[model samples]
Target: MGKGDKKSKRGKIINGTYGTRRKRKIKRKPSIEEKINVEKKK
Candidate 1:
C-alpha cells in the first residue's frame, strides 16, 4: 500500500486522478465582503 497502490492517496496523486483515496477540494462560500458587493450589484 504505497505509491503504486491505486487505493492510496500517494498513488492517486502519482496517477493524476481523484477517488475515495484522494478527494478533490470543495468550493468555498463567498466571503462577507464579496457577499455585500453582490448584494449591492442587485
Candidate 2:
C-alpha cells in the first residue's frame, strides 16, 4: 500500500474517531468513620 493509505489506517486506531460511547463513572470515597480509622493507624 501507499504511505498515505498506511497513515490513514494508523489514524483510525490512534484518533478513536469511530469508537463506542459509554457512560463515565467515578468511585465514591469512604465514610467518615473509615477515614478516622485510617488516620488513627498513622
lDDT for each of the candidates?
0.93, 0.55
Best model per TM-score: 1
Clashes of each: 0, 0
Q: Indicate the TM-score of model 2.
A: 0.38
Candidate 2 — which pairs collide? none
lDDT of 1 by residue, 1-42 (tens): 888999999999999999997899999999999999999999
- Which candidate gets the maximum lDDT versus the true structure? 1
